[model samples]
Target: MRDHTEFDSFAAFCDQSPWAFDDVADVRDVSRARLDEYVAGRTDFETWEEMKTRAAEEEIIDQIVS
Candidate 1:
Protein backbone atom coordinates (compact mmCIF):
# COMPACT_ATOMS: atom_id res chain seq x y z
CA MET A 1 0.00 0.00 0.00
CA ARG A 2 1.12 3.51 -0.76
CA ASP A 3 1.83 5.95 2.07
CA HIS A 4 -1.01 8.48 2.18
CA THR A 5 0.17 10.17 5.38
CA GLU A 6 1.77 13.07 3.54
CA PHE A 7 -0.84 13.25 0.77
CA ASP A 8 -2.52 16.60 0.34
CA SER A 9 -4.64 17.69 -2.65
CA PHE A 10 -7.57 15.35 -3.33
CA ALA A 11 -7.88 16.56 -6.91
CA ALA A 12 -4.29 15.53 -7.67
CA PHE A 13 -4.85 12.09 -6.11
CA CYS A 14 -8.04 11.53 -8.11
CA ASP A 15 -6.28 12.51 -11.32
CA GLN A 16 -3.88 9.57 -10.85
CA SER A 17 -6.59 7.11 -12.05
CA PRO A 18 -6.31 4.72 -9.17
CA TRP A 19 -7.35 1.13 -9.74
CA ALA A 20 -10.66 0.03 -8.21
CA PHE A 21 -12.48 -3.29 -8.19
CA ASP A 22 -15.86 -1.68 -8.62
CA ASP A 23 -16.86 0.48 -11.57
CA VAL A 24 -17.96 4.03 -10.92
CA ALA A 25 -21.66 4.67 -10.82
CA ASP A 26 -23.60 7.78 -11.70
CA VAL A 27 -24.32 10.10 -8.79
CA ARG A 28 -27.90 10.31 -7.69
CA ASP A 29 -29.34 13.66 -6.73
CA VAL A 30 -31.41 13.69 -3.57
CA SER A 31 -33.63 16.23 -1.87
CA ARG A 32 -32.15 18.41 0.91
CA ALA A 33 -34.68 17.06 3.44
CA ARG A 34 -33.64 13.47 2.74
CA LEU A 35 -29.92 14.37 2.96
CA ASP A 36 -30.51 16.23 6.24
CA GLU A 37 -32.35 13.23 7.72
CA TYR A 38 -29.51 10.86 6.72
CA VAL A 39 -26.84 13.13 8.20
CA ALA A 40 -28.85 13.65 11.42
CA GLY A 41 -29.28 9.90 11.91
CA ARG A 42 -25.57 9.22 11.44
CA THR A 43 -24.70 12.03 13.88
CA ASP A 44 -26.50 10.17 16.71
CA PHE A 45 -23.29 8.34 17.73
CA GLU A 46 -23.03 9.62 21.31
CA THR A 47 -19.41 8.69 22.04
CA TRP A 48 -16.13 7.26 20.78
CA GLU A 49 -16.98 3.91 22.43
CA GLU A 50 -19.98 3.40 20.15
CA MET A 51 -18.07 4.64 17.09
CA LYS A 52 -15.06 2.37 17.69
CA THR A 53 -17.29 -0.66 18.31
CA ARG A 54 -19.14 -0.06 15.06
CA ALA A 55 -15.89 0.44 13.14
CA ALA A 56 -14.36 -2.74 14.56
CA GLU A 57 -17.45 -4.75 13.63
CA GLU A 58 -17.29 -3.43 10.08
CA GLU A 59 -13.54 -4.16 9.79
CA ILE A 60 -14.08 -7.74 10.98
CA ILE A 61 -16.78 -8.28 8.37
CA ASP A 62 -14.59 -6.82 5.64
CA GLN A 63 -11.67 -9.04 6.61
CA ILE A 64 -13.88 -12.14 6.57
CA VAL A 65 -15.07 -11.37 3.04
CA SER A 66 -11.82 -10.08 1.51
Candidate 2:
Protein backbone atom coordinates (compact mmCIF):
# COMPACT_ATOMS: atom_id res chain seq x y z
CA MET A 1 0.00 0.00 0.00
CA ARG A 2 2.26 2.74 -1.26
CA ASP A 3 0.12 5.10 0.81
CA HIS A 4 -2.12 5.30 -2.22
CA THR A 5 0.52 7.83 -3.16
CA GLU A 6 0.17 9.44 -6.53
CA PHE A 7 2.06 11.56 -9.00
CA ASP A 8 -0.01 13.97 -11.02
CA SER A 9 3.05 15.17 -12.95
CA PHE A 10 5.47 12.25 -12.95
CA ALA A 11 7.45 12.42 -9.74
CA ALA A 12 9.79 9.68 -8.53
CA PHE A 13 9.28 8.09 -5.13
CA CYS A 14 12.73 6.57 -5.19
CA ASP A 15 15.90 6.84 -7.19
CA GLN A 16 15.51 3.34 -8.62
CA SER A 17 12.16 1.86 -7.64
CA PRO A 18 9.76 4.71 -8.25
CA TRP A 19 6.03 4.15 -8.50
CA ALA A 20 2.58 5.70 -8.10
CA PHE A 21 -0.86 4.20 -7.80
CA ASP A 22 -3.47 6.88 -8.51
CA ASP A 23 -6.30 4.40 -8.23
CA VAL A 24 -7.18 0.76 -7.80
CA ALA A 25 -7.65 0.35 -11.54
CA ASP A 26 -4.05 1.46 -11.95
CA VAL A 27 -3.02 -1.44 -9.73
CA ARG A 28 -3.05 -3.53 -12.86
CA ASP A 29 0.24 -1.87 -13.67
CA VAL A 30 2.43 -3.65 -11.16
CA SER A 31 5.39 -1.74 -9.77
CA ARG A 32 8.25 -4.21 -10.01
CA ALA A 33 10.66 -1.55 -8.93
CA ARG A 34 9.86 -2.06 -5.26
CA LEU A 35 9.24 -5.77 -5.56
CA ASP A 36 12.89 -6.79 -5.22
CA GLU A 37 13.14 -5.05 -1.87
CA TYR A 38 10.36 -7.18 -0.48
CA VAL A 39 11.49 -10.38 -2.11
CA ALA A 40 15.01 -10.04 -0.76
CA GLY A 41 14.21 -11.84 2.49
CA ARG A 42 12.26 -9.06 4.12
CA THR A 43 8.70 -10.33 4.12
CA ASP A 44 6.53 -13.38 3.71
CA PHE A 45 5.37 -12.11 0.37
CA GLU A 46 7.66 -12.78 -2.52
CA THR A 47 6.33 -10.48 -5.19
CA TRP A 48 4.16 -7.48 -5.90
CA GLU A 49 1.87 -9.76 -7.86
CA GLU A 50 1.02 -11.64 -4.64
CA MET A 51 0.28 -8.42 -2.84
CA LYS A 52 -1.92 -7.28 -5.68
CA THR A 53 -3.84 -10.52 -5.69
CA ARG A 54 -4.48 -10.33 -1.94
CA ALA A 55 -5.46 -6.68 -2.21
CA ALA A 56 -7.87 -7.42 -5.01
CA GLU A 57 -9.47 -10.07 -2.86
CA GLU A 58 -9.90 -7.62 -0.01
CA GLU A 59 -11.38 -5.06 -2.32
CA ILE A 60 -13.99 -7.53 -3.48
CA ILE A 61 -14.82 -8.43 0.11
CA ASP A 62 -15.10 -4.78 1.04
CA GLN A 63 -17.46 -4.14 -1.82
CA ILE A 64 -19.69 -6.99 -0.75
CA VAL A 65 -19.72 -5.84 2.85
CA SER A 66 -20.43 -2.28 1.91
Candidate 3:
Protein backbone atom coordinates (compact mmCIF):
# COMPACT_ATOMS: atom_id res chain seq x y z
CA MET A 1 0.00 0.00 0.00
CA ARG A 2 1.21 3.49 -0.74
CA ASP A 3 1.45 5.83 2.25
CA HIS A 4 -0.27 9.15 1.59
CA THR A 5 0.92 12.54 2.85
CA GLU A 6 -0.38 16.10 2.94
CA PHE A 7 0.97 16.78 -0.55
CA ASP A 8 -0.80 13.72 -1.85
CA SER A 9 -4.15 15.11 -0.78
CA PHE A 10 -4.32 17.57 -3.68
CA ALA A 11 -4.27 14.85 -6.34
CA ALA A 12 -6.70 12.75 -4.40
CA PHE A 13 -8.91 15.76 -3.95
CA CYS A 14 -8.82 16.56 -7.67
CA ASP A 15 -9.54 12.97 -8.64
CA GLN A 16 -12.52 12.74 -6.33
CA SER A 17 -13.76 16.21 -7.24
CA PRO A 18 -14.60 16.46 -10.92
CA TRP A 19 -15.11 20.19 -10.52
CA ALA A 20 -12.04 20.89 -8.45
CA PHE A 21 -10.39 23.58 -10.59
CA ASP A 22 -13.58 24.96 -12.03
CA ASP A 23 -13.10 28.68 -11.46
CA VAL A 24 -16.12 29.59 -13.55
CA ALA A 25 -18.59 27.56 -11.55
CA ASP A 26 -18.53 25.46 -8.41
CA VAL A 27 -19.55 21.94 -9.31
CA ARG A 28 -19.70 18.66 -7.44
CA ASP A 29 -21.09 20.58 -4.53
CA VAL A 30 -20.29 18.13 -1.79
CA SER A 31 -19.93 18.88 1.91
CA ARG A 32 -16.75 20.69 2.92
CA ALA A 33 -16.76 19.05 6.32
CA ARG A 34 -17.07 15.65 4.69
CA LEU A 35 -14.13 16.32 2.37
CA ASP A 36 -12.07 17.54 5.26
CA GLU A 37 -12.85 14.42 7.24
CA TYR A 38 -11.92 12.23 4.29
CA VAL A 39 -8.60 13.99 3.83
CA ALA A 40 -7.85 13.82 7.53
CA GLY A 41 -8.44 10.11 7.51
CA ARG A 42 -6.08 9.56 4.60
CA THR A 43 -3.48 12.21 5.33
CA ASP A 44 -1.88 14.23 8.13
CA PHE A 45 -3.87 17.34 7.28
CA GLU A 46 -6.68 18.03 9.73
CA THR A 47 -8.60 20.19 7.26
CA TRP A 48 -9.09 20.37 3.50
CA GLU A 49 -8.03 24.03 3.57
CA GLU A 50 -4.76 23.21 5.24
CA MET A 51 -4.10 20.40 2.82
CA LYS A 52 -4.53 22.69 -0.19
CA THR A 53 -2.27 25.38 1.19
CA ARG A 54 0.58 23.05 1.99
CA ALA A 55 0.20 20.89 -1.09
CA ALA A 56 0.05 23.91 -3.41
CA GLU A 57 3.36 25.14 -2.10
CA GLU A 58 4.94 21.83 -3.00
CA GLU A 59 3.37 21.90 -6.44
CA ILE A 60 4.72 25.40 -7.05
CA ILE A 61 8.17 24.27 -6.09
CA ASP A 62 7.93 21.29 -8.37
CA GLN A 63 6.85 23.45 -11.28
CA ILE A 64 9.68 25.91 -10.69
CA VAL A 65 12.18 23.09 -10.77
CA SER A 66 10.61 21.36 -13.74
Number of colliding residue pairs in each model: 0, 0, 0
Determine which window of 10 residues in candidate 1 has minimal summed lDDT: 19-28
Tens-digit lDDT track of model 3 for 1-66: 023463444445555553465542342365788777776876777877786687678779889999
Candidate 1, residues 1-66, lDDT tens digits: the string is 012212243233223322221322211244435434432444344433453466578679889999
Flag regions of model 1 displaced more than 4 Å: 1-44
Off by over 4 Å in 3: 1-3, 6-28
For candidate 3, the per-residue lDDT at 45 reads: 78
Candidate 2 overall Cα lDDT vs. reference?
Answer: 0.49
The full ranking of all candidates by lDDT, starting with the best, is 3, 2, 1
Best by TM-score: 3
Best by lDDT: 3
Over 4 Å off, model 2: 2-34, 39-44
The per-model lDDT (C-alpha) reads 0.39, 0.49, 0.61
Clashes of 3: 0
lDDT of candidate 3 at residue 47, scale 0 to 100: 78
Q: Is candidate 1 or candidate 3 better by TM-score?
A: 3
